[model samples]
Target chain A: MSLLKVENLQAKIEDNQILKGLNLEVNPGEVHAIMGPNGSGKSTLASVIAGREDYEINGGRILFEGEDITDLEVHERAQKGIFLAFQYPVEIPGVSNANFMKSSVNAIREARGEEPLSAKDFLARMREKSALVEIDKSFMSRAVNEGFSGGEKKRNEIFQLAMLEPKLALLDETDSGLDIDALKIVSQGVNTLRNENNAFVLITHYQRLLNYIVPDFVHVLADGKIVKSGGKELALELEEKGYDWVKDHAIEEQTA
Target chain B: MTDFNEDKLIEEVTTSDYKYGFTTDIEQEFAPKGLNEDIVRFISAKKEEPEFMLEWRLKAYRHWLTMKDPMWAKVDFPKIDYQDVYYYAAPKKKPQLDSLDEVDPELLKTFEKLGISIDEQKRLTGVAVDIVVDSVSVKTTFQKQLKEMGVIFCPMSEAVKEHPELVKQYLGSVVPTTDNFYAALNSAVFSDGSFCYIPKGVRCPMELSTYFRMNAALTGQFERTLIIADEGSYVSYLEGCTAPMRDENQLHAAVVEIVAHKDAEVKYSTVQNWYPGDKNGKGGVYNFVTKRGLCEGENSKISWTQVETGSSITWKYPSCVLKGDNSIGEFYSVAVTNNFQQADTGSKMTHIGKNTRSRIISKGISAGRSENSYRGLVNITKNAKNARNFSECDSLLIGDKCGAHTFPYIEIGNSSSVVEHEATTSKVSEDILFYCSQRGMDEAQAMELIINGYAKEVLNKLPMEFAVEAQKLLAISLEGSVG
Candidate 1:
């Protein structure tokens, strides 16, 4: 069974129709890279899959672990192994990232019929995982994403991802605000967390992120539909040619 | 159908009768159902107070007649009918008891339901408890243990009877009878409250706590509390209160005064959970209180911490007077209003001595069409050379319909004084809630985590027992705020 399957997904935010009959599927141990220009609904698709209420899913179904998850709430989707790393990480004042993660991890564990992790064990795991993104212990003690630099925010997201260890992780434009060094660190953290039982979906405007964490497949989205799909070479081809050709081809295909 | 059939169209609102809403049925004694000199005299005579105290009550009542009910506060309520309310009501069958077992079992059960079994508190925790129901204190636990350490802990009535000289010396020293409208009223009619005196250089061996409750119908509750810490002594006190749910709003006007002498320190905490009306804001407690402390000698310290989560309308400001050179005053508060509750609560710091320092941290959480306001004042006089003060007031709104406001008054007299104030108003962000939810917490859990984090500073100031109860009260008060 596929880890995640979006069948003709259609969604909108407010009065704006963003996702129109988008379809995609990811099996275990696979990395799918979604490349699109601005406003092509890349982030919308990621949010819809994560069950963000900001976008209204008007049609179609989302299946996770071979179970229909379209009707699930955001927290339910997350507990069922769907994670969306926000493009703009939210800064919550007065809530330390450590305390936030403790509640979250225990909640997910509780949802999975498992006992909560003891404070000693949880702190031990957190210390170990902080190294995944090279985050300082002090950063974990601070408010979630508060006063962090752009690089630190991205690294913190990846660190949270490492801690939660979701079966399906969605990175929404994860490489947009990062420098080369930070990008390498974030990508390394993502790579370390990947395994045969889990999958990843990376959404980006530029194909540069595909270099560090190489994708098995690349899908080009335009006008809310997948215009083209190919192997890793497709990303290099699009990077070389720009999106105009893909837009023209998509128009041609639509007209035909 | 066009006759405005209000009752037929909608059901009446009954403010949440919380866990402490259980009422014990007992024979009642009552003073006249009105505020007058005679009622004040009746209260004074019933308590068997001395001539000086009776004279003081008469003075306060006469002054109260010339004053008007304060309306400048941010809270709003219907006009209070002073003539309709009984000035005093006490359980006629109860008498002073030396041991907990002698108290009425029904009264004991009421306290038990409120999560405070004085017996359990006595056995498990070292905290001394003074339990006051309606107009009297029935029992005080750990009196013997405290007496050995030269610490006097008893009801105000008992203290006036047993230690008249001490009570006479310090009763109205911090908060005078003419302090405010409510303070004057409390001065005239306050039936019973806690009284404590820490002897010179003695650190109190255990925490002192008081639980005040209002039970009799149509009776306004007025309580007076006084604590005096002698030279080089230290004491920590905690107070908690609740009332039964009713369709008619009940009145609560209390006066609390503290005096700290040379090198003394006093820490006072309150977790006020009066009944906040139902979802439609029909009925709840009207809490108007005057609380103040005086640091009378050099190097003295006074700190006030409060968690107010109930009351239909709350108008209170716990303040400190820094009279001693090198004294310190700190105010920490977390006020929450939900379901048509309105709270205007904060603290005041008056610096009069050289090198005095004070700090204020307040958090206000509003939900369910309620209004929560933080009103504070800081004054540094000319003599307060090198005085320093820092004030931070933060407001958190849960629903879009709720409101939060901050009003801070700062007055600095000399150039050497330094004062800083910072405030932030924010609606509980949907993104933060979503972030927590996506991490697997439900809405209520996420809301509590965020609210607690926002209130961490003020909550940390409460002792362990009160801290736990305050957190739970905050969670309960904010129910139905989020989906």
Candidate 2:
């Protein structure tokens, strides 16, 4: 069964059309890397799926676990195990990361009709998750993403993803602006959290991330639609050449 | 919080009904509907005060007559008719109860509705409670336990009679009878409040607290609180207050003074939840308070923590005078205003001796169409060498129509003094709220988390017994402002 199926999704921000008939499908145990150009609607897809209110969905039917989630709110989608790791994590001063994660974890537990964890158990789980991404113990007590370095912010995002344990994790440029060392830690964290019953969506602009976390399928998003799909080697080809080749060939193929 | 039905929550929060609005039915006594020498004499004579006390009240009333009401506060209200307000009103119990157990059941229920039943406290932890209704202290609890430690805790009136010298020495030493318009008014007609004195080198066994309830109509609440920590002693005091809802705004002017001797520490915290008017801004309490502390002798310390959530218009500045060498002063506050409420509160720190230090952390949250401001002053005299000061003031606005302002006055006469100040204004961002909501917490939980985080620094300063209540108060204060 498919974990996520977004069919003919049409969305926009104000007057401009951002997601024009974008369609995709991912089954359990699959890692799909959606590589796209700068203006391509890669982040918009993740945002709309996460139920951000900025964009208006003109036409679409998003089905998660065979249930229609087209009109579900953000938190409702979250309770259903859909996670969107933001590109730029919001900084909430005075709210320590430990407390933030505790609230989030307890909230999800309550939604699942599970008992709330005690403080000791919650701290233990938080420490375990922090160690997943090589996060220092001190960072957990500091304000959430407050005064953190760029690499630290990305690592923290992955740490949250590991803790949440979402069924379908959507990564919105999660690997952007990180050096080799930080990239390895983030990818290792993701790999550790991977399982057969869950799926991953890696949205990125480079094939560098694909080497660490190999994707089963590679799709090129351009002009608000997936123009081509192929094996993981397609990412290497696009890296060797530029994305202009994909756009030109797709246009010629469409005309023909 | 997990049961997430936003429409239902919004509907519930939007009803601007005051929870403690029901008036208590009890006999009452009044001095008169006016302010004059005769009225002051009546109040003091009724309480059977010492001769010097009457002289002090008369002096205060005479001073009050010469001075006009100060117009400097950033609040707009109708002119108050001093002659029209009942200067004094007290519950007339036929046979006044002798103890907390024997106190009037109706009175106990009235306080229980406000979450301050003395019986409950006696059953649980031994929190010494002084219940002040209208113009008199009804019952004081745990007096015997506190007395064993050489710590004196009782009503101000009782203190004046039992410990006359202590009261006479420290009563107006911190806040003089001629301090300000409200302070003078309070000194003239102040009826009942808690008074405490921890003996030298003795730590107060338990937290000392006072709960003030106003149930009389056409009356004003004037309370005076005095606390003194002798050498090497430590004490933590908590205060809470409420009033019945009425169509016409009532006057509340209170004066609180604290003195810490050498090597002593005094911690005073207040949770002021007076009735804030309805959403239409019809009626509430005008809470004008003057609270100050004096650090006398070397190495003394004073800390003030307050959570101000109610009152139609609040003009309060809890200040400290660092007169002792190596003395320390700190102030932590969280003032929240919603639905036509206005609050202009902060602290003043004066460094008079060498090596004195002060720290201020203020958090202001404004919702609906309210206005919240932080006005503070930090002064270092020439002799106050090596004085160090640090202040951080932050404001959070929930709605677009609400407002927040900061006014910091810093004076440095000592070239060796080091002072640092920081101020920031932030709105409760929808993005942040969405971030929390998307994590499965509902809007109310998200809002509460954000607000608690914003107010954590100040709330952390409060006594542990009151921190939970203060957190809940912050959430309740911002109920209808956000979705």
Identify the CAPRI category of the predicted complex in candidate 1: acceptable
Cα error, residue B392 of model 2, in Å, equals 1.7
Q: Model 2, range A23-122, lDDT digits (tens) per residue?
A: 8999999999999899999999998888887778899889999999988878888888998888888889889998899888888988899998999988
**Candidate 1, residues B1-483: lDDT per residue as tens digits?**
111112211111113235555577777899978988889889999999988889999999899889999998888888888889888998886754776767877888888778888888989998888888898988778889899999999999989889999988998899999989999999998999999999999999889999988888787999999999999999999999887777778899999999999999999999999888767888888999999999999999999999998789999999999999999999999999876889999999999999999999999987767899999999999999999999999998765667899889999999999999999998777778778887888666777788888998889899998898898888766644322
The residue-level lDDT of candidate 1 at B376 comes to 94
lDDT per residue, candidate 2, B1-483, as tens digits?
A: 222343433343434467678788878998878988889999998888999889988888888888888787677889999999998988788335466656677887787888876777877968888888887888777888888889999889989899999988888999999988889999999998888999999998788998887888778999999999999999999998778888888899999999999999999999988889987778999999999999997999999999999899999999999999999999999999887889999999999999999999999998777889999999999999999999999999876677899999999997999999999999877678767877777666787888899999999988887999898877776665332
User: What residue runs in model 1 are displaced by over 4 Å at the alpha carbon?
Assistant: A254-256, B1-20, B95-99, B481-483
Native contact fraction, candidates in order = 0.55, 0.49
> What DockQ values do the models have?
0.42, 0.41
Candidate 2: residue pairs that collide = none
iRMSD in angstroms, per model: 10.4, 4.4
